[model samples]
Target: MMTNHICFIGGGNMAGSLISGLISNQYPTNKITVTDPDQQKLDQLKRQFSINTEIDNLKAVEASDVIVLAVKPQVLKVVCDNIKTATLKTKPLLISIAAGIRSTDIDRWLGGNNALVRCMPNTPALIQAGATGLFANTSTSDNQKNIADQILSSAGITLWVDNEAQLDAVTAVSGSGPAYFFLFLEAMQAAGKQLGLDESTAAKLAKQTALGAARMALEGDDDPTTLREKVTSKGGTTAAALASFENNNFNDIINQALTAARDRAIELADELGKD
Candidate 1:
């Protein structure tokens, strides 16, 4: 386990998930601290994780080597401002999990020239089954990057992009990816119900099918395309369904949706970065 004194700047669900992942990986409870405005939330985390809890953000920053910015994006600027002085004094590596915020904006907010890693993690992270895309600012060292990777990977798989712009694509793909799958599951469940299955049975079958398909995709040697081809016989039910999807331009629909999502992510960065 890493011995770095890690501090989480929020006590929300994501923060709790990270703390849980760290503890499950045997990271030292004594080396972890969480700071939040809500004493009750802090108290709950303290009881649950046995880690230190503080209401003073600066005090927590001063005591840590790594700071996880797990707060909402709208309040991140204020949180950064609140702890800027202590962050400068301690020079802790900042790992931000806030969505749609840029590294440049965060660096500027924190007095600049700070080592920071900005990552986009999906909601599945709450269950330790997430996919995260990370990008490090130029000031970040290789060791700091590795540390950030270790921290995020505790929740799920981590991938690094060569440039920050790719993070926008990552945001569209994985950050909002869970919702796309959930929507598909919803459609499948509804279709099953239309096919005469009861609501509960349809829901169960759809969810289990999704889980099994995901597991197979993750564990199988064949690529998704190959797997699909193998499962879909020519002129069969699966092929007919796929043909209907093609007829309706499913690939183009997905492309347009992701493009729109990426555009929105870029717009959000611009909107959130403004002083």
Candidate 2:
């Protein structure tokens, strides 16, 4: 349970999703505080949740026990600087969900004494099925990490990484993984359409097959490779398709794409650290 009042620095979709999930999971909605420059978002949040909402960042910073910086990467430094000025020695455990921003940069931006946790969560979180990867600075306490986990796991699964560098890989994998799956689904639907099926029927078949395959992989005892081999008989359609993929080096293509994404994530972190 979130015993401390958490203040969100932004009231966008991600922030709103976290807040809604937290409230739904038995955390006190009244203990949540939201701050946003946009009045329309603030108004909508206020109407949806019984929590406190404010336009002034300073007041929200002053009142929070745990401050979650839910703003974008571009505005993170500015928001951190404002919170630093407002709170000074009273620095709370700061949790940031901004992609590509390191905890060291967060600490430096806030004058280097604050406890900070940096995390990456995918878009599936909006549907309460997210998987988050968390990493914290040396200043963070065990209890603070637990709190952070609870807040995040309200939407889905949460895992901690020992090496901060692993977050870059995580950003490439699970953080951007959902989009890859979505893209695959789209392509499959298109392929189905090309095979003499109507768009709606093709979509239904594609989606259900994808979902069933995922469930089978997760629930069965066999490994993915083993399970795949079970359905792929010699000279069958599945075997033919698998052969085509192997011939085209699909595995290598996926590896290269993920590596490129990881490199980009690292580059973004470096850029954000440049002051």
Candidate 3:
């Protein structure tokens, strides 16, 4: 049981997932409190997790050792402003999970107090199979960083970035990476359907094949290319597929797509951080 009290500002899906992870992993459910404007959401969280609930955001913050800002990116500044006074008084470790919003911007909105950590976690976090990239502001202490790590690790994997700028790369790779895989899977399913397989059969095959391949990639000592090469024999069906993809410049397209994702992430940061 952790002695720390953690409060989440928004009772959204991501926050609910984290809370669910924490309780299931025995992180002292009584020590957690969630505040949201939606009474239904708050009631659901409280009933599901047997933790505290509040509509008074500042009261929750003042009672907490950590404050997780899990609100939407567009409304984050207003949330920051509303909670600024409580933050200054309590000085809890602040962790923001809103994407594309920088820590400097959060710090500025919070009256220039540091002790901030910004996290970009993908949708897979809702299932506790997430990959998260975290960056801490200069004012955060080592202890607070550890707390952030502990909280997020309950949901999935956590990686720290030395410079916040590299988070844009992280955003492109893992944050947006799931959707890319989903697109590929969707293509495989569609192709299977086109080949006369029933929709259910095609979906099952595509999903399981993807899961198995991902497991192989993770569990095997070989790199992805080596594994791919191992499956791809000369003048075989795999060879035919590879040849087609190569002819279509698949690798170049993937590179270009990820580059575009990174660039767009930067653009979003600029757009959301504007006064």
The models' CA-based lDDT, in order, is 0.94, 0.90, 0.92
Better of 2 and 3 by lDDT: 3
In what order do the candidates fall by TM-score, top score first?
Answer: 1, 3, 2
lDDT tens digits, residue span 116-199, model 1? 999999999999998999999999999999999989988999999989999999999999999999999999999999999999
User: How do all models score by TM-score?
Assistant: 0.99, 0.96, 0.97
**169 in model 3: Cα distance from truth in Å?**
1.2
- Local distance difference test, candidate 2: 0.90
Ranking by lDDT: 1, 3, 2
What RMSD value applies to candidate 3?
Answer: 1.1
Stretches of candidate 2 exceeding 4 Å from the true structure: none
How well is each residue in 95-204 modelled by candidate 3, as lDDT tens digits?
99999999999999999866999998988889999999999988899888999988888789999999999999999999999999999989999999999999999999
- Candidate with the greatest TM-score versus the true structure: 1
Better of 1 and 3 by TM-score: 1
> Any idea how many clashes model 2 has?
0
TM-score: model 2 vs. ground truth? 0.96
